[model samples]
Target: MPTLAINNFNIFCATLGGFITLFGLVSYLFKEKYYLSEALISLIAGLIFSPHATNWIRPQEYALNDIEILDTITLYFTRLVLGVQLVLAGVQLPSKYLKKEWKSLSFLIGPGMTTMWIVTSLLVFALVPHISFLHALAVGACVTPTDPVLSNSIVKGKFADKNIPKELQKIIIAESGTNDGLGYPFLFLPLYLIQHIGHQGQGSDNSTRVAMGLWFGEMWAYTILLSIVYGAAVGWVAKKLLHWAEERKYVDRESFLVFAITLALFIVGTVGMIGSDDVLACFIAGNTFTWDDWFRLETMDDSFQPTIDMLLNVSVFIWFGAVAPWWLFAHSPVIPIWRLIVLGILVLLLRRLPIIFALHKKIHQIEEARQAVFVGFFGPIGVSAIFYLYVSHEFLNGITVDGEIREDAAYLKEVMEVVIWFLVICSVIVHGLCIPMAKLGFFIPRTLTTALDSLGRTGSDSSDDPQPAFQQAQAGESETTDAEDRLRRRPGWSRTGGDSLPTRVFRIGRSLMRSGTSSADANRAPGQAPLPVSSVPTIIDSGDGDGEGDASAKVDGKSDGSEVSTGGGGAAPSAPALGEDVISGRTIRFHDEQQQQRTEEAKVGQKV
Candidate 1:
């Protein structure tokens, strides 16, 4: 017999690696891909073929005898995965969009989410009379946060047809990043309600109200706002410490982010232990970190967040499938099948329409009503929801109101659970299916779309033409710049900020070098500052329609390298420059007069 070698962790690693590898194969095998979404693939695979190496029972009863391990899995993995993602999402969002479209974003994530939660709560109460109202509301709030993983899978798939509006997609991504954190208050409301309900029957009004105030008011309200404040504090604090450490030669320039990432994790753990919500804190932290847009870039955009999210998300999804009681459909003799179907449909349907209609009246940045409707409906519950679902399970399992255990506690827990599982299945399927039909038309009325368009200012998608705005500038052009601006792109200095693989890494490194770089390593010369690659050289447009003008060159040079450095410019990952390592996309170009003077006047359109 072939020797079998695997443990729980190893099985998990194998599943994650194997699924990811298979996804790559599927994607490459069929260039014209349709059904190879990573999230979808993982979910299906988990359902069919997980190792079940842990406490999970073979038949998929979905029982929680080993709640501790499951909770650990959900808590630790979700925090690490979702925490970093939330932060990256916030940091990487273009500041211009935040400023220009704050109103629209607010409408999308704020009132839109609240309205959906409220509607779902109402529907749950109306349809499933047996489930407690507060419990239903908790699930409502739980489901309110949209899953970007699912939405992105669809938008990125062949089904999107490149017609999925960019602005709309951005709004969805931004809103999903936030709504999970924001929606937690409602989720907690139910648990608190469950605690209070039995106590209220005991008729200790003063005590109950005080307990409610402590949990709901102080813990819930004050904690969320404080987490936001704490988040802002972390960003500025990290930067200050980073500067201090670098200036003191305590850390290497290349390892600067080690300090920042450590600070983030510390802040998260400390905040959570202190009784404030850490998820909200971390999300806000990401948004607040590197308030400057230039510093907000992810070092390796292709490999960083995408890779982390995929591994963590895919593992969780598959594990969820492995543990998911798809058998619930069969064992759910407690709730009628028709009711479950109706509840699931109502949960999904109630998500979009109301929010879009309400938001259209005030959000000027929204290009169309149908577009808003499309986004509102696209609110699929994902990692965060999964985290909360397990949390809800933990919160609801066992324990009766007062000392006397409610006989129906088991039934109530399962009933509430049935709704959640149904929602997950419905969301994955419906949202996934709807991707193909996205281009057909919006569900909103044409008259409503026209009215919203007339009432609100019209918006256009960003230009699709490949040439970047900087390249549009005339060469040798020197213009007055704001004293506070740090942009390196001026005449004579062409900024190819997209140098090498990690723009964030290089950008930050370049900034530190300019600020007096000091390496901690003893082998290297102590205070060597690495000079930045000047902007990419382009034909100087002489402000003429014929592209024949040169603006005055304002050279802002910062170099400890009086010894001229050659081959300085950085390369974009997809767009390699001439004379560069193709695999790494690294390049060498002149940034200063010392090096530039020797540079030949290379012909235009020549590679490198």
Candidate 2:
């Protein structure tokens, strides 16, 4: 067997490396400040250096002028990228997150995904002339699943950490990762419809029922169900083996770092060879592999997987940009340029936003209108769409002879590829620029305010009141809502520096407790000066106070350098601190003194 020449290998590597090196210096600013993404950057590079522009890198020519070779490359390339990214998503999610957020995930992957498929099909049918409804459905199915690759741009960066809620980010990650594989059913349904009825002249209603049954058995049962079982089993076995090995000092850190990527590709290959849902299996396997949290914790701080994931993403986008059918956009005999633009715009706008927005109240993760809008708008059509495009092509290619599609299926193939690719390009651009555009007020759904208090500002009405401004703190029972509790309970939660919600509230409560004036000070005249900081009594309320503000101490007196009566209860041991994120009621005497001094100065100024 002969292989293609590596004539442009050095050029390709040098070009890509140079582009990556330049982008690396400013990537932080792009992600953290400007809100741009590698997808957009690499895409622009592909376009600028593509055959259509500089003709610097031509993949089509490399395939020896055979489009099937290029299409095959694309199909497997996307499969690998999607598989690895899905597994990474599975690993990074908090433990038992799927079980906890099952309700919201069901709504998103079920109704949310179906709505996108149907609406997109309708748009394709309406915009493109001479296209059958079934063919249009094929195109819609291609774009139905959100691209996990593109979504990482918005959901996993510093911009997201500061501006987006963690729950919302997790929802997007889970939804995108799961639905990409689930889209097989949607894509194959239309293809089966076209194949059984339109292509072969099996016009009977009974045959349609049979085709549906085949889809259920093959696509759903074999592909989905079996893939999940297989993936979970593999993950469990791998996890146990790794644990057993590490306990005996057999496994090293390097092997652990590569485990996720290795598992992802292994599942993708073995599962694909068995004709099951490879991408879904990859995610399921990853989730189960990290279910016990040992592997994730051990490798939590390693940048190996993330760095590799970035490299995969950058390469694919660049390849996609280079191989994109620019000629078809202007020269397609079936669909006009104006119609394609309209389809792209409409698909991007209507694909997921309205359906998700309508069902926001039902999704526990989506608590605010802004969150709903963000989730809805950020479902980008990217690598997964490209992957499905070729899958549709191969399915339609079955009826072709000598590289020419039969007349009946040729137009379907043309419309599907053209429309799908156009949407992908538009989605990559629109969704990639979403954050920066939102920042500039050119887009809706502006960034959310950071949940953590930045400047130590507590939830208090006025400092001059001098009563215990507890700010909704409760003893024993927590004041945090279910959503907040979920966030606080997430693994790897930081307990210091007011970053996490519970820590901020804890700090606020402790600070207020120490600086609070006594009941005698509260009864002073409106313009009367208050006592100095040294005279104030520090009476700590345990938040189990009656209507008269009476309570006991809960904090361990040994840790805080202060003691209060425990009433009838014994002092409890302090909670064990993880790493440096210890949550303690340690006294900041200088801070308390400065706060009291400011209060006294305020009262003195009021007296004058």
Candidate 3:
């Protein structure tokens, strides 16, 4: 081929690589079930077709140096993409939304920090024989925080139970939002100790105190405080500028691009100059900026989310795939394959068990409790692991003596890099595939019921009473009844009781309708006739007096096929017939059955 033709072909190949990456994301949007597998396949194809890997096709002995350029390019690109994501995240934070959900925020912080500490500490102890305790600690801290970007894609609103407390969802989002930044100090602490510990020789005791003080007291504490303060300051200023631009009708689209880039660079420079964690500072700044009223960033968020998502998908899955050191599994000083498996299993279990136990007490219900545990179990190590490994390599490089690095330093770098890559790739695949599939069978019916009950209680306290026994029975018997018949029948009353019945029945009927039942289903059951009772209506009035009836009276009223009887006195009513309350038990059971049927139908359809 002519030289000009060859250059054009190479450029075309590069373009094709980019197209493959974009295609992976597009495929995910249309058919999420095949997302991971398709991304992985496309990434492999892109790598094979890329000009950068042409040397590998010639059967020459492979060397790391040959691929170094590609790796470095991808690494820097990932950082740039991550930086932009952090800035966008900061600029879009609904601080008011988070503030109102402080309980959820608190829940996230408590569990996340605790899990990080516990998992890291345990891993340090478990991996002590193979690796230094301090090194293990560093790795543990690095891997502890769940990647918010990854989790956000998986555990979003659609995947999560609708009846779950909004606060809990907020907690998940905010924790994922903030914890990666928060975990940086932990990532640095052990590495700092490993580096400076030997230099403190004869005065080791004093040196130890100083290092500890700096790591925990100054480095951790000061960095966090400063990031928050500086981030908030920047955010406050950005908010004002946004408002001014809006009022002047000068808030051009390009302005956002300029603002994000400038803010990111400024935060990175300032944080680096001050010896603080730049990533954390950037995240804090982004969060702060997003908290404002005038920015109305939700609009920007909607527009930018897909682009950010695309960038992240490419940066994480394909770019990383193209540069991954696939040869490292055959190399030395890394733990043997069997040992890695044992360690991986231990890490997953150790991380999951603690979180499960912690959340069980706070959240009631067995299935929801199980799901919480499952989420904890699958907290895969991601970009944070790479960040830590990079930091370790830099630290090791800085401590070289006589212009020569220590022999172990090279091994350490390789091990850290390979291990992080292994973990990240594995996590993306495992969690990515599992999250979608797991949603199928992970129903928490009791938790959902409790949530609905709580919402009903808090949203309107006046309607707090349980369904009456007579109404419960009528609803049960009327399941086969026509839609109109069910609607016309007053709640807690059989259809025979005409419109002349008291207003309480109408109120109960309304509550049932609002409780996610169609007006059709709310009517009396087919072939079920209204009960004839002189005493029952009077009893219902007495029991429901002042709208604070006995618990049994309310339960009976709500149950299927139950009946209520009032004595002569104005006291509470007696329990209705057993069948009256039976329907109450059936409502939830029926809903669950319907859901299961739908799920099965979907599966069958997919198969076909």
Candidate 4:
């Protein structure tokens, strides 16, 4: 074998791997403290080490700077991430959730998405010079769908589990997953028209009519109908086969965890060959796969999906940062920097918020103004936008020669890419910071208290506990009580507070450090202490629940596969079945068989 040359490729791999490792180490801290998203972190990393900056990792150079190669890489890479995320979303959702929320979901993806497209197109038409409404619609379609990868950051974390209502979280995730696929029709319609219209008035009205016919006959029939059918078929089959294998004890923990992703990739590949919507197929397949809820319940607790999702999402965004067309933003005069900035702001503000806010009352999922605002404000233009941008570019390339656009259609490819990139950047930063800012909002009262205390104008203190009133109520208190307490403790409602600014900040920092330590303890192997069953995490508690017997029996399920009771009684108390525990209102299944296998292996090692 020839000796491997140590070039930028190896350096890039090493650097990328190292950065991923570093991020992985601090990811929890970043999420807990700063509320930063992984996409935002990875993008910044890629930017810092990219060719345009330090030149430490030249991904574009690795592709030899060929536009076709870069686009191909981006397209496939994004395809994999979006497909995986959509399926993951589909699988994790409560069974019958879509059916139950059909009306609300339909409204979001239908009327809501249309409004976004229209507003975005209007913005693009007004801001960018010499762009037609059709091309602007195409660009608008690219950024209309909320990115699943970015939305996951908002919906699935510890903060969301506490702050966002479960229904609202599900709605956000469902909308992002469904609309990404639905956005395809919006994009292809405009693209088909542009292709038919051709360069500088070369096409006639008859060809335009043909394009309209093709849009329905070809794109709709093939991309939508076939995709949905094929997806449902694949999902049902996979679910059946997996269930069969599991019943036979042929499927282990690894296979159980890996199966969904493999199925998602299979859907993506097969759907791509048929020229159907792979992302939509993956979503549909996932829904069909877990329609009965068996698979989802079985694998709910011990999932590898989030880890896989994070890795793929981080990789795609990093690649995006490296290969972004910074030059296009800088040098393109027709779509100048000022226009791009204005368009980004207008698109962000007007795209989905107005529509969603206006229709919040009609939408059954949205309960209140705050929830509606939260949902409306977080429709981030991220990975999905990048994926569609390249799709539009490739389609335009087929129509135009050598990646060149006609004089009249300046909005087709070049200007579209610029606008999409700026929006993605804006979205990544803005949406990523949203939760952090909300967290900051929660601390504003305390900050004021600190200011007053430091100035020695502090009033009489009430409670010695450092925990906020809202936090105390979250510890199994009634919702009404929690709401009342929060209102009473709201800024200017009371002066009964604690230490000065510096001391309060220091104590909060120390509390976080201790919480991390306790979390590690909570996750320790069975005999120590049982994890808490309440909505609030065990780590946040002052200490573990007061007994050892309760801890061991709850964690280590009975050897005979019987339910373990909580209290000794004439009639045994109702308890979760073997290998399952209810935590935070969800059934968390443990791998009892896997644990037994490891125990036996340990015994064998001891005997040897």
Candidate 5:
């Protein structure tokens, strides 16, 4: 076959691979249970067959050479696709949304990083003993950053409960977004030390300190701070440009200019100047530019957002499939069978357990706890992991002159490749499988429980009376009446005009309701109120006779009177009968007297 035909064939394979993977993912979106599995299968199959297909079409001598032609082709496609997808991801993120959900994001960081560190440490100590502590730290750093692409794909939005705090969702998304790039420094620093630490000595120490300082200070902190500032500045400028364009009726021209300028500044300028990992700069720039005004522009369509995202997704995944080192599966010496198994188990446990423990106190529900666990465990090592290996190998290879450091370089390269490859493969499989299972396990139950609880609460609160009225026949001693009155006067039931009688009835009936309800429900009954007997009203028919009776009648007649009158009335008011208003439908009551008592009690409680 001709070379042109072979190249065309390889391109065709790439396109086909892209199509299959995307189709499966799209199908998964539509609730197809097997879609993810099918997608994974298709992905694996394409990875295996696409190269052979390309080879058959164009049998070149150097096709499978050191750097596979197939790999290079895929990598370029991946970068192109990822770039577009990343932009869309940025566009979709509204600044207001992030700000509102900042708390959840903050809460997640501690647990997430802790999990990464602990697991990485344990794994390095246990499995790869030959590797230094620094190397383990490097591995921890590499794996620490969550892969937004993988996490976003696996954590199905539809499965999540709507009531689940938005903060939780934002935390998950934001962590995934920022961490991928963050892990790069961690991955690079250790490898750098491993290679140069001994030879460079004091000078190396200084350089290392400088690099570390830069890594923490400039690249991490300064870059993030400046990106926000620059992005905001650019956004402000874009807003002004947009206003000018609108005033001049040059809206279309203005929009096009805005996009072009933003694309150049964010994607091209930042990456070109600072290096490829400057994704945060691009994100902040896009974020700042799209702030409130640009979104208001009539000509600026949101349709472009999804299209860009899809293109990026296709590119990133295809490249991932294409360039994946099949040789690592067959022959990386650094990651032997024991190491692979140990690392895999350690990574999963370390990544998840700490998050579970950390979040358990804050998240009350069991399902949320389970979700925290699942999300924690399934953090698949992704693009950053591979990127780390690539840079490390390149650096190490550059250092080796002749055979002097070749062994060490080769060993480091092998270790990086094997470990990364294992993670990638395991993530694709484990997370892919767990995604569906997690949906079935945690998300579904949590959603169902929330729905049921909400319905029950709504039903209880919407009833007539909202608290039960005591029966007239049940009127007894004043103490009994006082107890019942106290129950009625409890703060559990609000006396707003909007409240229905049935709701009150339900509140009161709860105490008399049959046993077998949960203890929590029983404790919530309105009858648990504590009020003085003197604060309760005693109901008397006109025939009940005695000076106390007249006084009680007068007290009952008073609109705001809640306490029993105790002046020198006949028979000392006869100790006020209990259940005085048991069945009196005309009676409406509140805790006016009890409230004063409660204030005093509260003050006492506070002092105590």
Candidate 6:
């Protein structure tokens, strides 16, 4: 008796139709900070509708052949989408941008990512009973690789700037983008161990150590080394081939460029099927194709890649909903839903957040702690996690154990399915709500509470407070006016403050004058005294030893911190002898009464 069978065609149509409908709704009614977006709506609809349509959780048993075929098809779709993402992420970003954010990049890929994996795994082991450490860690590792497909909604300036630091979007985008490709080894290694660890000796007397050596030499090497070499070679060949075709005028339509991307992805995936790492190869090709000597390689348009990416992404989610034992998890006597929610909270609050904060020494681009916290919250374990979970279940599907995750593939499958589905579902809702909350400024009061009451601090607001202009610019938008560039160009801050700009001057910190160009009324924080509409001549830092602000900002009666007035005549303020910046907040400028009087006296003396 087959448990569930929707046939491949129906699965495809449902995902495609649902995706179209969801996007249509989002486009029509959900543009504002007020409404729910396509991603959330699609997920909810799929959870509610896909399963019943497919007979997913009924007593009928699926044929082994049908199940395996469906699994293989979905697996390919995952690879295709992942391949496109790798190419899009790698080719689009300049090497210089990576260099600029290397410190953040280091932490994101290394400690920050790893620690989250470890912490979340430990929490799962503790909370989710009947799961072995290896399986738990595998789940943890899967979740650690974030998809963040819809993350742009909040990070690209949708959140009210008060709760979210939009600048952190660069880190989030780059981190999520790179890690999804890089996480293959971590995800697969444990599953390999769990499936083959104790059984290796049946073929030959293979001990754990021997098995590990073979696994490392084979899987790891293919993943790290061969994959890179093959991908780069493929990239080179494709580039030349496209150039030749273009020269011969065979390639005329821009839509044909989709083939260029899809072809490369297909080649990479084929190599993986032959035992190389699909992800690493695609990622390498993505980067390699974008290099200088590519002769204007055929590239997919940014808009097209996402649309293509969404089709597969939604298919996986909808398919998961259709096949997964949603009824069992909700009604099953094995694990209560309340306990599952508690575990989710524990991992999210304890495991997810603290690691980000602890890694702050490296991720300096986050100017405010609240920003780092917001990024932490929106770190949704999305499509890639689902892909890895499917792979894990395939490997661990039939195995059973007496100690923890018992025999009975159905039970084990249900457990893994429940945990993953629950986490992702919760993430979708929590992450979805946060965007609107940010837009509505719900976090502003929370920000005050965290800043003053929790931290036990008080401050007056100055122009140094958070600036909307400092937030990251949208694609194709001009970045020349952004504070990101301003901070990065400064030398010392590159290693420390993370695209550092002296942002706010609270009451206790320093009195900051309004940017000469900004409207005073709009910049003020709630519960803070209004800044005078009379604009102070803002010292725009032309930056790096160009003493320009010195000449322009010095009002005759006002004191530039490093200047003084003589009684008889105004003497020029001596330029700071060192090119080294004082490593202070953008220093506030004000005139003392004594300096004002001396300037007046000097003026009188000059008149005489």
Q: After superposition, how far is residue 584 of candidate 3 from its true place, in Å?
A: 48
Best by TM-score: 4
Q: Candidate 5 on 180-293: residue-level lDDT in tens?
A: 445555565566565456343422353566556666775556655565565456556765776677688876754654463346345535553554454454445555555553
- Candidate 3 segments exceeding 4 Å error: 5-75, 97-107, 124-129, 155-166, 199-206, 216-218, 254-262, 269-275, 296-301, 360-368, 407-411, 439-608
Per-residue lDDT of 322 in model 3:
53
lDDT of 4 by residue, 324-428 (tens): 877778788668788788877877788888899998998877888887887888899998999999888777766644555544444467777788888999999
Instruction: Between candidates 2 and 3, name the one with more favorable TM-score.
Output: 2
How do all models score by TM-score? 0.65, 0.72, 0.62, 0.76, 0.59, 0.62
lDDT per residue as tens, model 3, 1-608 = 65555454465456556665667446535334333433344346445643346432211112234544444445445455555556655555566655665554555566756676667566645753456666666667766766655655444433444434544444554556576677767766776676556432321232556667777877767777777777768767876787788688887776654676577778766776786666666666776676754454445534455455555555355445555666664454566666555666676667655765576555433247655775566455666566555656666666554676554455556656766666666666666676545544354654575567545544553344343333343433312223333544646653333433443355345544334232334454558654433222221212222222222222213322233333434333333332232344543332223333333333432222
lDDT of 1: 0.57
RMSD of each: 17.3, 13.7, 15.7, 11.0, 18.6, 16.4
Query: lDDT (CA) for every model shown?
Result: 0.57, 0.76, 0.53, 0.74, 0.50, 0.57
The alpha-carbon lDDT assigned to residue 465 of candidate 6 equals: 30
Across residues 171-230, which tens digit of lDDT does each residue of candidate 2 receive? 888898889889899999987777666554533233677778879988889988998899
Quote model 1's TM-score: 0.65
Q: lDDT by residue for model 1 over 1-608, one digit each (tens)? A: 89877555565566567766877656533222334455555667677664344432232223244645655565566666666666666665665455567788788766777788888888877777566676678767767787756766644533444456656656666777777777667777666656555433642232456656766677666778888788778876775665677679997644754434555577668886787767777766665655555345534333444555566666667766775656675568557677778888877877667678667767664567776576557678766776677666665554464554444445556765666767787787676556535423453465565556434422323344232222223233222122212343334333343332333333333333323222222112338644343332222111222211222211122111122122445431122122233334435332222122212212211232
- Consecutive 10-residue window with the lowest summed lDDT within model 3: 538-547
Better of 5 and 6 by TM-score: 6
